[model samples]
Target: MTELSLIRNFSIIAHIDHGKSTLADRLIQVTGGMTERELKEQVLDNMDIERERGITIKAQTVRLDYTASDGKTYELNLMDTPGHVDFAYEVSRSLAACEGALLVVDAAQGVEAQTLANVYQSIEHDHEIVPVINKIDLPAAEPEKVKAEIEEVIGLDASDAVMTSAKSGIGIEEVLEAIVQRIPPPQGDRDKPLKAMLVDSWYDPYLGVVILVRVMDGVMKKGQQIKFMQGGTVHLVDRVGCMRPKIEQLPELGPGEIGFITAQIKEVEQAKVGDTITLAKGGATEALPGYKEVQSVVFCGLFPVDAADFEKLRESIGKLRLNDASFTFEMENSAALGFGFRCGFLGLLHLEIIQERLTREYDLDLITTAPSVVYRLTMTDGSTQELHNPADMPDPVKIDTMEEPWIKATIYTPDEHLGSILKLCQDRRGIQLDLTYVGGRAQVVYELPLNEVVFDFYDRLKSISRGYASFDYEQIGLREGDLVMMNILVNNEPVDALSMVVHRSQADPRGRALCERLKDLIPRHMFKIPIQAAIGAKVIARETISAMRKDVTAKCYGGDISRKKKLLEKQKEGKKRMREYGNVSIPQEAFIAALRMGDE
Candidate 1:
């Protein structure tokens, strides 16, 4: 077993595509953790979606043995974390398992919104941070400017920061030396009662459910009985293992070391993330602090394109939920969409990842509805309720005030596009609280309604900023706003999944835009269809879709007036029957397309 002083647990965090995974690959290669034949680009990002999108969707941990210049071999447990704001909870869990962090910043892009947000999160955890200026080999790289910004913006001393190009393998040795020299070794007593934190967990087909944990106090060994502090469920440890890129069975995991353990657990909920694990015989009296239960912020309805696949979709989601505990779903019935599930996610990117996984992994065709934010509903009887779906909201005339969740948004962008970015933010009902310049870029802070930004806010921000802006947001509690539920009615019938909560000031314009967009998407039926956007019983916007014309007089061309009149009467009778009994068949694409009205 390695001494505690020779073990260093750290995580690599940065903005998306800022060379985090690339640097991780370089580190893994440098330490001989994986041979050339075994090494691949973004090796830590095992998910196909992660490699295709060039983003880390999940937190990955690996153990590396490196011989430092000091003639000492150290056990380095490097945890790579997702950079998107949606995965902040996952990032925090990763940070809790580390003693230090390498804050990677792109030399060309300098400091981004996520970079600063993650740096602050690291600071809050009191983790020793080593700022690394990456991509120095690029033609546009400005290491000096980036180094200065790190000091000025992040308030970290950058003079000692390692400047490296992960692609070119430059400064790889320097980074390894820095990790050994600068980052403190883990400090914990091995004689204490067993205390470990379950940072992450996933389901394995053969091994059942496996959990990645950081041993904080005592040793964890195979055959030992353990109990989850929060869950109060006990189990016998079937295996104790370490991640040598892949899980390798370990006889025991000592204090300050990271590894995985399975106790024959089958359900993912049994081994909860951020929960404490201790020996069942003699465990610590109190659980660890900073345990956070993951909650979903944005919600949407997910339905199978084929009605017969409802049960299949449910089974697929159940399997997925075993691996992803953050996502939540419950059965829902829709008027337009048959049977489906109302799913909740962390954010937009998270929602996309799950959808992509369901499609690719489970081979399911799905139709997703517009996203909605959780709202607080207060009634006249001094009662309160939380509404996630718009259809679940109470009546507007509930005799009391309604409040919607608000967010504190922080955006970092180039100075040249500051005006347009701020204008876009204001248009989204953002209240600008402050604006400051970091280096040559602008850092703008605003308090905006969460409902406003949960949909197309990120895309719009990227558009107006010319794709040079980075955004991060956090909930700032609920605030009373002029909120209303806008519903889309096809042929004067409301589609529950298409209903959304929008501010009154922007409701009319948004409703009109949605109605017009849906008009082009929904195919013309045999009878005229009226697409209307309504708030309660009041129709705020309307668009008419004309029926496809088929001339009934063509067959009676110059035959006779009586024959022509008879054919016309027959057509009229058919049209009346169609209007009375024929329901509009909205394709799955139309429901999904309704959410993309602002994409163009």
Candidate 2:
């Protein structure tokens, strides 16, 4: 076993597309972690979705052995984490397992909103940070400017920050040397009873459940009976190993080491992230401080396109939950969309990723409803309830007050796009909290309702800023708001799938837009079909799809006016009867087209 002083655990953290993964690839190459034939770009990212999107959704770990210039070999545990705001929790968990972090900044892009958010989390965890200025080969790269920005924005010392081009393998050795010199090693007592933190777990077709763990206090050995401190489930350790980008079995893992363990666990749920693992007979009396439960900020419904595929959808969702614990769902039936699950997610991106996986990985076609945020309602009887779906909202009269979730958003943009960005925030009912200048860029902070951001705020922000602006936000709890539930009616029948909760001031315009879109989407029937958007009994907007009229008078050209008029009267009566009894058949395409808001 390696000495504790020769072991360093560090994670790479940065903004999206800022070269975290590329730098990781360079480190693995320089350290000879794998053969040149076996090495590929983003080797740690094994998922197909991650490869296509070029974004790391899940945090990945690997163990590498490096020999320093001082002629000493060291064991390095590297955790490559995601940079998107939606996966911030993943970054946090990865940081918890490391003693230090490489704070990567794009040399041309300088510091961004997400960079600040993640650095703050690392600082909170008391991680020793080493600054790395990446992409120096880019034409627009300004390493000095970016280093100064990091010092100004994050207050981290960047005087000795390593400048490197991860793409071309420049400064790769310097980065490795910095990691070995600057980062501290983890401290643990191997003589104590076994105690390891379950960092992550996932299901395998052959291995059952594979768990990634960080040993804290003692040695974890094969064939040892271990118990989960939180779950209280005991099992025999089947295998002990570490990933060199591929699994390599080991006899045991000592204290301050990161590795994987398999205990023949049947399900991933049994191996919870952040749960403490220890020897069943003489484990520590107290458990480690685990991670906080992730709160899903956004929710929506996912239904199969074919009604008969509901069971298939259920199984697909269950399988996905085994790998992703943050995603949540519950059974709900809608009159318009049939049976489906109302799912919860960390953000809009998380929701999109899950939906895309359900479609691509499971080969299932899905219908997704408009995304919504959780709201808290206080009743007249002093009771409170959380509303996930607007269709399930209580009557307005019974709700004493309704509060909507709010978020504190930080936006970084070039000065030229500041005006449009501010206008976009104002249009979404946002209150400006602060404004500051960081060199040529403007840093703006706003407090906005989560419901407004849930729809299309991110898309609009990117369009208006020309993709130069970066934004990050954290939920600031719920606040009282003038919110109401707006329902859509087709032929006087309410469509629960089309209902949503909106602020009072936006309800009328929003309702009008939905009605107008539905009018164009619903096909012409034998009788006129009326579409209305209403708040309770009050109708705010209406549209009518005119009937397809057949000319009965075409064959009566030579007949008298009375005959023609009688024929017309007979046709009108028949149409009136049909209007009273005919049911409007709305095609599936209509629902999909009408739910796409902000496109117009």
lDDT of all the models against the reference? 0.90, 0.91
Lowest summed lDDT across 10 adjacent residues in model 1 is found at: 552-561
Per-residue CA lDDT of model 1 for 412-522, tens digit only, reads: 999999999889888889999999998888999999988879778889888888899999987779889878888888887888878888899999999999988889888
RMSD of each predicted structure: 2.3, 1.5
Q: Give one digit per residue, the lDDT tens place, for model 2 in 422-467.
A: 9999989999999999989999999999999999999999998989
Question: Which candidate number has the best TM-score?
Answer: 2
Range of the 10 consecutive residues with the lowest summed lDDT in candidate 2 = 287-296
Q: Enumerate clash totals for all models, in the order shown.
A: 0, 0
